[model samples]
Target: MSDISPTGLGLRHSLSLTAGTPVLTLTGIRPAEGIRPGDRLVARSGAVAVLAAETSTLPQAEMVAIGASTLAHGQPDETLLVPADQPLLLRGARAELLYGQSAVVLPARRLLDGQLTRLLRREDVELVTLTFAAPAAIYAGELHPVTRPEPLALTV
Candidate 1:
């Protein structure tokens, strides 16, 4: 299959495991799920991707760049968390890959200047990850989701 997106953007057609309940990745200093109970809240996004846990389920040809999870998704020891009240910036991101499977977080301003996929390819990398410890948006030109958030109290 060709890696080129027919529209030069991206094709959105995956079913969210949440049964089409659209979600926003909470961006910034967030922990794995379960840190805060019932805090399954996610940041809203005009940008989202239909994702499957495995690459084989969703064709790689469809993705310009991929982040192969820094944390084990289903690992027994891994815990997940979400923030109820978080400050969100609905923008895109450009992930600077670090030494190993880790990711280097950069300000989104540095990312907004160019298309994320094309930028990464230009930078000579394919594995771009969005840090959940900051405001990271992934839309058409960007990749999938990851998030973080500054501490905020839950709102009623």
Candidate 2:
């Protein structure tokens, strides 16, 4: 999948994906905001051109919606889907998970607040750091010895 940067563009014009395609379909009140077809959309996933069609149907629904899921070797095992059109959030200090004997860790950051954090925490979350930015320390309070000392001569 391609990645797109969310830069310029009005909030009402946020991008939406249809059937996992890069093409964006404008919905909600955005169309009333003068966001016509053929306009460009700046999405978190990437930029996409608006389709020349308006959807009068309701927003599509997903059977299983989770925030994030970890897969191994491109195999789908664990899946976390998030329903609704908003973001998720996770609280606490840190989050950790062990899937198929593999560990998945997510550090807490302040920017994770609101929807992002809530959505994550709502699902199968392990640890939460609860900070806007990662700790300034090298290991975030993880203790480790600097160096081993050499033996001294005691017979002198």
Candidate 3:
């Protein structure tokens, strides 16, 4: 199935399960559902990919590349605190800017800069961290919320 966005960017489709998958379940950081199945993923003409957790269920991803080193390894489903103006290569995953912070949670792919050493050095975003359960630990045929944050308190 082919889906098109209002921006006219053709939604690229890939088999949910491809042959010889390099990474079966991307752990260490939460990945946006866009990187998952049943959705469209897009990146800039020549931008790197950084796996990120999904903050919302939108069909658009926005990112900014501030510098050569702006990607950091993150735990699956964890929020990464980053500085604004930092070069970011975001995949097609819509995100929301949290209050009191300039960091954003958008869909991202893997880092693709040849300067792995340097990039790894400079790209050190603070990761909130997450704990992933093994496939056997997860119960199938059950429904659960994909994203659920801690409840906030309201001060009346």
Candidate 4:
């Protein structure tokens, strides 16, 4: 697949996995500004999320670059929390991988970057994950996902 996506710039789909491999899932939440419980969240172009548990459905490809629809706005003090021990029910954009025997579940709380580095660096790294839902006006390419991101180093 082409990494030069209009939505995902600089993100390279170099992970050697089948089209339908289960890699990651929506699990937990991290502290961020302007985000609250029920506030719509979505992953930016290159942001990566770590899965906490395994699933029998959902595809792997969908886990690579996840995007979601608007979330139900919550009270200003309300916070959204995802358990580090299960999968989250996210709406908008489909997931290709299901957590299962063949699924690629990294260590609990471990984060996989846009290039899948945290996953490649170590198989047992637990990542702290969060789900971000964007407003209908915000779309991919307009926002950056990863915080401390390493550019994808592709060997052509």
Write down the lDDT that model 2 would get.
0.25
| Predicted structure with the largest TM-score when compared to the true one | 2
lDDT of residue 96 for candidate 1: 23
- lDDT on C-alpha atoms for all candidate structures: 0.26, 0.25, 0.24, 0.26
Give the 10-residue window scoring lowest on summed lDDT in candidate 4: 134-143
Order the candidate numbers by TM-score, best to worst.
Answer: 2, 1, 3, 4
Error of 4 at 9 (Å): 26
TM-scores of the models, in the order given: 0.19, 0.20, 0.17, 0.16
Give the alpha carbon lDDT tens digit for every residue of 1-156 in model 1. Answer: 212244453322221111111233344223222123232234344423223221112112111221222222322121111111111122222122222323443322222223321122122112212223224343211122334332332348
Total colliding residue pairs, candidate 2: 31
lDDT tens digits by residue: candidate 4, 1-156: 423435454432211111222222233342232223343334433333321112222222122322222122221122222122223232222122333233232321232333321122222222332232211111212222222222344568
Q: How close is candidate 3 to the true structure, as a TM-score?
A: 0.17
Model 1 residue runs over 4 Å out of place are 1-102, 114-142, 154-156
* lDDT tens per residue, model 2, 1-156: 222225422122221212221222233223212444565434333333543333332234431222232222311222333223322222122222222322222222222334422333233222211111111111111110011112222344
After superposition, candidate 3 runs with Cα above 4 Å error: 7-9, 13-22, 25-156
CA RMSD, predictions in order: 16.7, 22.1, 17.7, 17.5
> What's the CA error at residue 33 for candidate 3, in Å?
21
TM-score of 2: 0.20
- Kindly report which residue stretches of model 2 are placed more than 4 angstroms away from their true locations once superposed: 1-34, 58-156
lDDT assessment of candidate 3: 0.24
Q: Which residue runs does candidate 4 get wrong by more than 4 Å?
A: 1-120, 135-143, 146-156
